[model samples]
Target: MDSKNYIDSGILELYVYGALSEKESMEVSQALQQHPEIRAEVEAIERSLTQLSTAAAPYQPDQVYQQIKTKLNFKDQEVAMIPITRKRTNWPAYIGWAASVALLIGLFIQFDKNKELRQEVVQSQIEKNLLEGKIQVAEEDLTKTKTILSVLRNKDVIEVPLQAQQVAPEAYAAVYWDKESQTAYIDVAGLPTPPPGKVYQVWSLKLDPLTPTSLGTLDSFNEEATKVFALNNANESEAFGITLEPEGGSESPTMEQLYTLGVVNS
Candidate 1:
């Protein structure tokens, strides 16, 4: 572009405002270098803006250049005008700042410690609840065991010993009968574990006629720790016998599978 037209386009104003693109700025700089009149005009614009900015400042310094010279020891050295930042040396002011910093650090540490303590308390409460649940289950088990023991030790109950039969000569059991209540507790603690997929069934026998009546099947024979089972015996049982059967007890006793037998006295 021609010089007069380029200067009139208002791009030189942008260059003075520092808003020109890098290429445009370089072009303007070259133009200023090539033309003394253009360079002088740019310098005049810069000086005018600088004066306007200085006049817009809130207040002029009171003591002016002399006071600035005295602070920098500039009379002998001809030092460049530069601001001197003041330093603080008051003991109380330094102590107050240090104390404030220490307090802030202490407060931050306390906050972290409190957060950790709250988390631990929550964890402790969860563990305590779990332990309490376990304790409740254990107490329930104890109550059930106690109830069974009380029934077995009743005064009116009749005790019957069962000796091992030919099939299982080492196995033994005992039955406590409450005739009036029609309940009998079979104690199979001495009996051996039944084979897998097998169970022991109790038979109420009428010895006079040699007839057998089915009582309930004794399941969980191996899993039961105390090996005690309860059954309702309403029939007049003259003899009690235990026989190993399939998963469920047979309608009639499997005589070959008999494990233990006991006869009640007349």
Candidate 2:
């Protein structure tokens, strides 16, 4: 039966009043043993009935407990009786639980710290890779610049100093003309700024007839940090000159705006 069905059977009330037969009492005891809810209800009804019977008494028993104790021979007992067998320590269980909780908290904190350390390691690796890439690019640029420097230092190369001319007397430049390589490296370190919308153009000049050949314009003059440029010249050149011209440079040299002139050494 369900708990409510068992409760409504009135068997618990009969058991509480001690009015049930032996077989019925045994059945009720079995049901009470199986169902703790039914057992609790039976105990509640017994207690209520016991209280009612005690209240129904005309005179309360003062010596009744003493008489029952004498019948059981428990009067004037000297020896103390221990009720339970297990030796229990009050605080150890709480201390063990607290210690376990503390240990777990410590482990979790360590785990979080380890995770953070791992992230730091990964971030550090990325930073290292970025730095290495920058270093490699710098090394490559350094290698190229060093090769150019070595070629300019060769003994066979002729160095020419291009002096500032009348149009721009403050501007001066130098050229390292490698006749064999047909290459000229111009260092315009002392050159002044070109006028707005104009650029400095290089010219290869033959002195006998004063014939001039256009080499190329120094297009990136303002933006160059070193103020140096390289040009190819396979000419039987006698002199080098720089002139200021419009953006694309003139087909011929603009002698009026000439900035510098230098003669190649024999």
Best by lDDT: 2
Q: Which stretches of candidate 1 lie over 4 Å from their true place?
A: 1-20, 25-133
Model 1 Cα shift for residue 140 (angstroms): 3.5
Locate the minimum summed-lDDT window of 10 residues in model 2.
78-87
Q: What TM-score fits each model?
A: 0.54, 0.51
User: What's model 1's overall lDDT?
Assistant: 0.76
Most TM-score-accurate candidate:
1
Query: What is the Å distance of residue 71 in model 1 from its true position?
Result: 45
Tens digit per residue, CA lDDT, model 1, 140-234: 67876996788777877788899998988888999888899898889999888788898889999998779999888989777666677878999
**Residues 107-179 of candidate 2: C-alpha lDDT, one tens digit per residue:** 9999999999999999999999999999997886687577568667888888889998887778889888888
Q: What local lDDT does model 1 show for residue 202?
A: 94
User: Model 2 off-target regions past 4 Å?
Assistant: 1-3, 6-137
